[model samples]
Target: MIDLLKEWIINIASLVLFITAVEMLLPDNSLKKYSKFVLGLILMTVLINPIIKIFNRNFNISVYSQNISRSIYDEDTAKSIEKYKEESLKNTINNFENNLTQIIGEKLKEEFNLSNNKLEVKAEYVTQESKFEIKYIKVGINSGKVQKVEKVKVNIGEKNIEEKDKLHDDIKSYLSKELKVQEKIITIYKL
Candidate 1:
């Protein structure tokens, strides 16, 4: 409660300071003749700014809580999976990460016309039951706009390795079409 109060006080104080600075910048005669203009500026700063901030805060809080809940559920499920307990699983996951990075880098360069230096890629593997699920997160810079791509689940089952490869290829094809980049330029991470 105290922390929330402190934050509110700080935000209100900042808004007041911002409004006062703008008021001070105007010519003295102008402010005197057009006091209504000063009142309008103050109203916008004090009312609209806080309303916008409230909506932003609400959105962020909901998003953060949802992510936290999902992560907790995933961790619990992973703990019960037999494959995740095996020592070899770690090495397999590491190799998968390396492979995904290379693939994603190549794809980004070809499909999105992205430079290798401007692409950021991250991949991780999450296990459920006997299957491995890959998650890929990528950011590509093209013409100053940062395009973000995420694939939440890619199945890599031991008996379906060929199918998994096909899925990966399909993802590359889809991203190339959607992002208007060459299929070679899109990067896929194992995560």
Candidate 2:
């Protein structure tokens, strides 16, 4: 170690002397500035050589570079995985809503005899419970369309008016029971 220190000092001294000599010989021109910059770099390298040697004894450049690349690749892969998860979740929610709407439309036609209708289901995933929750449902039906003909011997005018009002409540109650949600979350409108 003592011999290495002595050699390092000698190398630094020689580099400094050479730099001084070169600076003195160069004329005052554009090249003088460039030469001085190069000499300064050489001086810095010589001065730092011993410290570099000591630290570099155990340092493997290839292994260090590989580790760096691996970390970067891992970060990129994690981001891609997160993005994929978000897209998959979005698609799942959309498909669930569409299928539910189709089922609701079919049921309305079969049970209520109402064909001209539009259904919108609002739902979201509850992260805390790890389940999906229905937020609200809106059903639009045209009143002028054909409805279920119930055969009851009563005043037809009053019965028809009563049926029109009761239809909204009945639809809301039906959807509430079928969806397992509160009655208030379902809304029916005559379009």
Candidate 3:
């Protein structure tokens, strides 16, 4: 142990002297500015590396690098998984909304005897205690034209839109009562 201590002291002293000699030989230039910082970092690594290895028998460069790479990989994997989950959730919500709109369109067509209709439904919802509740739902509907006698349109132009809009009071009344939503959120147009 005594010999080891002496050897360590001698090694450190020689390293310090060598660094000083190198610094004296190098010109004070832009290159030296960058090189000195690099040199100092290398010196610190050299100074501590042997000490670390001596105290920690299990320490190795390959193991340290592998651990660093593994941690980075884990972080990247976690990030990708989160991204995928977010994308899937967004797609699911979009699909649900689209399907809801389709169902609403079908029900309206069946009741009103319309052949084709476009229905857009918007809703404001909130989650409380992991339970979802809708605050308000807005509905916008338009009639489409199909070139057949069986396919009939409610109102096709601006002139008919104004006339047809007033005729949807029964529909609005039904939706307001059935869905338990506000009357202001429901809009039906025949255009």
Candidate 4:
């Protein structure tokens, strides 16, 4: 609390000193003699500086009381966090697939400029008897509602079957005309 007060006082004092030094350099006349120095000092120190100090005090109290650093995570906490992240990502992909049917229904409205939501994207991974299959759907606005779908098959033993890379080429090809996404933007990898 004391430190905060000191900082605010320093800031206001610096500003007043700078303004007073500038005012002193002006031409010396009868009206500019004693009155200018006194008025400038009084206005800066009494009015502007106090108001600034009040604002700074309120801001400092609010920020300190908020206790933002209490949310920091440790190493074991970080590992559990990563586990949750992977699970959530898997659920997200499944939800995307389940929502695809309804999403496709709205594709026509989007493509014809009848709706503000212009694109619908869906992705899924299918574990087959001997291999893995990735499927992606891109529904967008073209002449009317246009839907494009792409599928990629990968063997279980393939090291390149990371999630992001698995569908990189297919997604790029599918949405090439609709979205100007760069190659680096799409990433896929297995957990």
Candidate 5:
């Protein structure tokens, strides 16, 4: 077992030295990144190969090495990887938007007693900020039925309840502050 560990360490050190030498020889250009990425993957495979062998005595590193080399230079494989990355990013963004809407809806319902709520959150990657930024938020409320005054109002000294217009402002203000968005970018409407 100690011999095996020593052999793995020697192999990894030699690979690292080889990779560094090759990286030094590589010209600084767009293709350098691809070369480095492939080299890094190869190094990872080398690092994991010993562990794999420990578990499966019949495991073949040569086959995996050949496959990795074959796929590394394949243009179709590169394009497919790029496409997969794009699709993954889109799915993540969609999930974030859905989750944000649900959370905001629940918060409004709990805080403002606003039900039948709809929310639209538009977000985009901001390169300057190095993060995703919310472009705008649109909230729609569907519970806008005015109940009939069941009795005549005879009390002249009682404070009136907060109005719906104030409620709209409050919701907008709350969302703007909570989301770190401008009030102008947040639109609240009755449906």
Candidate 6:
């Protein structure tokens, strides 16, 4: 074993010396550093080659890798962790949106002079880079059996916003401040 190790060490030293000589002979350029790095990697592989050979027949690499992987991530535990993450994310976003809609409902009550109990608050989520993102807020005003207003005609409303629109500007500024997002990403609606 000592003779084998000594021979391996000699071989590695010779290879490194040869690589160094070759690199010194080459012209300095943008690729010189990269070439040196590759040569270093080659020397490392040569140094480790014999050590790997020493263990070649003694251990089963496939089984060892399987056991290590299992220890790192058990199937059931991985599944459960993924599920927990999804649920927690969903719950947190839902609670935030619920609170947001409630606030909007109060604001709507103030804006439209509606009673507290009649506004149905809901939110619509639009897809961003991820699966779901808050895009539009819908506040349903259900003034049940109000004298003349219930009979008034209602029309479908468009949500296009211009820079001159004060309500959109106000709401956009408010949301941008409160939610810490750009106004361009949010839209509000009343139904």
Ranking by lDDT: 5, 2, 3, 6, 1, 4
> Which is better, 1 or 3, measured by lDDT?
3
TM-score of each: 0.28, 0.53, 0.43, 0.25, 0.54, 0.38
Clashes of each: 19, 0, 0, 9, 0, 0
lDDT of 4 at 72: 56
Candidate 1, lDDT over the whole model: 0.58
lDDT tens string, model 1, 103-168? 655766676555543434333455455554444444433444555674545667643222235545
| Winner of 1 and 5 under lDDT | 5
Q: Please tell me which predicted candidate would have the highest lDDT against the true structure.
A: 5
Backbone clashes counted, model 4:
9
lDDT to native, each model? 0.58, 0.81, 0.66, 0.52, 0.84, 0.65
Candidate 6, residue 58: lDDT: 65
- The candidate with the higher lDDT, 3 or 6, is 3
Tens-place lDDT per residue, model 6, 1-191, is 89878998898889978997988888999788888888888888777667777878565545776999989898888999999987977787787677876776665567645444332323344436444455555333344454453354545594453334565467657656765666666654333
**In terms of TM-score, how similar is model 5 to the real structure?**
0.54
Q: Which pairs of residues collide in candidate 4?
A: 111-141, 162-189, 163-188, 163-189, 163-190, 164-187, 164-188, 164-189, 165-188
What is residue 52's positional error in candidate 6, in angstroms?
23
Supply candidate 2's per-residue lDDT for 124.
82
lDDT of 5 by residue, 1-191 (tens): 99989999999999999999999999999989999999999899989989999899989988877999997869998899999988977887788788888889998988888888878998766658767777778888777587565555566777533225887899989988887889887778765
TM-score for candidate 2:
0.53
Tens digits of per-residue lDDT for model 4, 1-191: 68857776777677678667857776777766676767676555544544565677554433543665445556778999999977976897777655653544353345433343334444545546432223444333233345465475858876544344423355445444443444443333221
lDDT, candidate 6, equals: 0.65
Tens-place lDDT per residue, model 2, 15-51, is 8888889999999999999999998987887777678
